[model samples]
Target: MEVVQVLHMNGGEGDFSYASNSLLQWKVISMTKPIVEEAINNLYCSSFPTSLTVADLGCSSGPNALMAVSELIKAVEIIRQKLKKKPIEYQVLLNDLPGNDFNTIFKSLPNFLKNLRREIGGDVGPCLFTGVPASFYGRLFPKKSVHFVHSSYSLHWLSKVPEGLEENKRNIYMTDNSPTSVVKAYYNQFQQDFSLFLKCRAQELVDGGCMILTLLGRRSQNPASKECSYIWELLGLALNDLVDQGIIEEEKLESFHIPKYMPSPTEIRIEVAKEGSFVIDSIRVSEVDWKVSNNNEVNKAKSVDESLKGSGYNVAKYMRAVAEPILISHFGEEIMDELFIRYREIIADRMAKETTQFFNVTVSLTKPK
Candidate 1:
């Protein structure tokens, strides 16, 4: 499968678009705010550039894209205010897959610029923003052109599905029941993808340039940790249900798999060390526990059924925005409504019994002088 073709958030301002259901991503931006600040601060402390070029890799459309850029510019302004230096010109690049919704991104730029002007008036210099349509697996900028790089919740996606993965007949990603070959295939793919990622950035980033990446990762050394594995497992289960009901073919489930892998902290460290492009500045693992969009209403509900239904409805919508395009590509667009109806029921039922959380691994690295 061509990731460039199938991998993009649902587009348009419609109810099912990623623009409509990205609160979870927004929350992730909020969680990684400090790391963003820290990276910007490091950039400032390392011979602050008179004119800086910053890139946000895999910056998907929606509120979160601008939010990340806003925080970055805020960091720069804060440093300038303290030192009382001349205004610094900035060139900001928003990058995503070629098929990304660049139109929606451009549509919101005027307001973003207007709001930006409100925040840091005359004190800051002129700013230029451009959308770069491409993947980050290779060089996207000139050598030593970028001062800092930031990515969030995007690196977990592999450049391509791992080879030799056909053995995992029942799983979407590495799961408790996944064979050792499946686990090895995923791990090897991650190593290749991440090393290429670092190498590309190493060439693009100036010496001492800092890069901060926040991605879905596992806390436990085990590949099957629920923190990162359960969602796909549950989705696989939903697909299985469709198969049992004869709504979809069994072969579709066998061939269809999510192109995401959640790496462990140890795996990350090992790969970073072997790549030998940058030095690790800081790496942190944080847990984000699942919660219904509105707990107040959930508690107010009189029946357990209502609460579960509500929880599942919101989550299913959220997941659908991000996952719909891929599912539609393989399974056909006709079954999306039905597929997610069952998905929501499964999620709600699971949530009612237990709380789920995802581990976000944030790493700040700097190119050596």
Candidate 2:
């Protein structure tokens, strides 16, 4: 079965726009810095070149990538200072899809570099930064070129939509009560994409290189598990309402899915082990509370109220971003406002039931020495 190539939604930075939010900076620092430091230390201990090259796969626009790069440089400097070696040149590669907002990233780079230079007082050696526009599942650099690779909150996205989903005209995802057939298909697609990702990364990394990845994940293998986020369920309900009102046809909605898969940490370990190129180093699981700001909450509530007040058109933008694109294509933007309003209320209710959000898994791995 051929995979469907749905139009990419959620834009370059992925949902939640972490790149632009200052509150998110600390999250990236705490999660990414130590893993990168470990990778660099291993490389240095192995007598790898002092000039290290690193790649930040799925690096989107804005300050987040730069922030990560800065931390990496500092970690490398500390390692060098401890070893009493002179500073060495570093080459950093930032990669994302071709259509990503490179303009924003380019605009942010110079200022970031200026700040870094001032902080280190020009002691940090030559640091080269460049952007590579290519799919992470394909070859984007020369063999054995990357010393360390890192990705955060990006790998959960499937390389392509599942096969037979578009052909069978079935929703790519289903709720807890969804049929076994639908769930099985989704799992199979995830398995395939994950295997491809491992194969691709294996080809890119040097013999002893390391990859540190953090993504949304589930703790259970049960397809009926409700551990999946309620945000998705609310969005599905909104889309169904639109379909009921004849604002959008069912066919259009079936063409797209959420493009997310939450695999268990054990499942991930098995896949990586099967690929036989990477050894699992560590796994960390934690709950990430992703509450929007008060302003956003207020605005969302306002939008919902307006839609409920017969101005359903006003909430389309919010719903469209959260809803399946196929629904938007068929509905023609008429019922989006109402859909969003209803969706927000449902999500808020769910949140009230559970104040702290639960679930995420981080896995650190290394290629054989």
Candidate 3:
């Protein structure tokens, strides 16, 4: 599959769409608010530009699409008020793959603008929102144009699946059982893609501009550790179940692989040092429970089994919303319902035995003047 062409969060606001199932992503965004605020503040105070340009790379469609932009705007407004500075004109760029639901983000703009006006009023400058449909792994903006950049739950995605993975067999991603060559290939691809990403962004960002990025990561030095591999391993098990029942072709499973890699914190720092464009301001590693949810009152009433089952289903829906497009591209859409059903059961069974969480890495960087 063409990663650029095929990759995107599930579009629109449906039960299974990314818009409806992005609580974990939202939590990551919220968790990194202070870092984002500091970056925006630092950038603003550096020059106090009359016009500030901010770019949200991989700004997938959903309530979370404009979330970071909103934070940046609020941050700028607060600083302006504190220093008694003039209004700073805002240029916000929302970027993602061409297949992203730009329409969904656009549809919500009226309310977004209305709320911004009500909250900040005339003190806020013109906030121009533009959607740039392109890949962040390459240049998407002009040189020295963007003042601040933010991306959440992106960057783990490789520009494409690594080459020479035919030996990877039934796995869709790096697994403990993967051959040494497979592991090396994945890391090599990540290093190549991330370096190019830094180079492109370095060109796009003005001197002393700031960028904050949050992505799925592995705490373990081992790329095959459960932190990053278990989720896909379970999904692979679900696919294997289908193959055993003659529902999917074994050869298809062998050929299909996800174009994503969860790097470790050490790996991230190493890349930043190697790239030589940005200084690493801060790097934070945190974990969010795989069973992330907001349904507290309802959960209190359910039995242990009921809660576990509900958690499994919720996690399945979240994964489905994120992975459905890629899976559908390779496996066809007919088996989706059944695939996720099996996936839910497998997750529930696993959760009954142990707690699982996603490792997140949030990094703050700055271009030296």
| Winning model by lDDT | 3
Q: Better model by TM-score, 1 or 2?
A: 1
lDDT of every predicted structure (CA atoms): 0.85, 0.65, 0.91
> In model 1, which residue pairs have backbone atoms overlapping below 3 Å?
none
Residue-wise C-alpha lDDT for candidate 3, range 94-169, written one tens digit per residue: 9999999999899999999889778875577888999999999999999999999899988999999999898898
In candidate 2, the residue pairs with backbone N, CA or C atoms under 3 Å apart (3 or more residues apart, or in different chains) clash, namely 315-337, 316-337
Which run of 10 residues does model 3 get worst, by summed lDDT? 293-302
Off by over 4 Å in 1: 292-305
Model 3 residue 297 CA deviation (Å) reads: 8.2
Q: Residue-pair clashes per candidate, as listed? A: 0, 2, 0
Among residues 3 or more apart in sequence or in different chains, the pairs in candidate 3 whose N, CA or C atoms overlap within 3 Å are none
lDDT of 1 by residue, 1-369 (tens): 787788999888787888887877788889889888987987886786789898999999988878888889988888887888778898999999987898998899999888887887666787798899988998899999999899998999988888887878856677888899888888888889999999999999998898989998988888777889998888888888888999888877788778888887778889889989999888889887655343356667789889778777777887898888888888999888988999988998999899877788888898998
Best-fitting candidate, measured by TM-score?
3
Descending-lDDT candidate ranking = 3, 1, 2
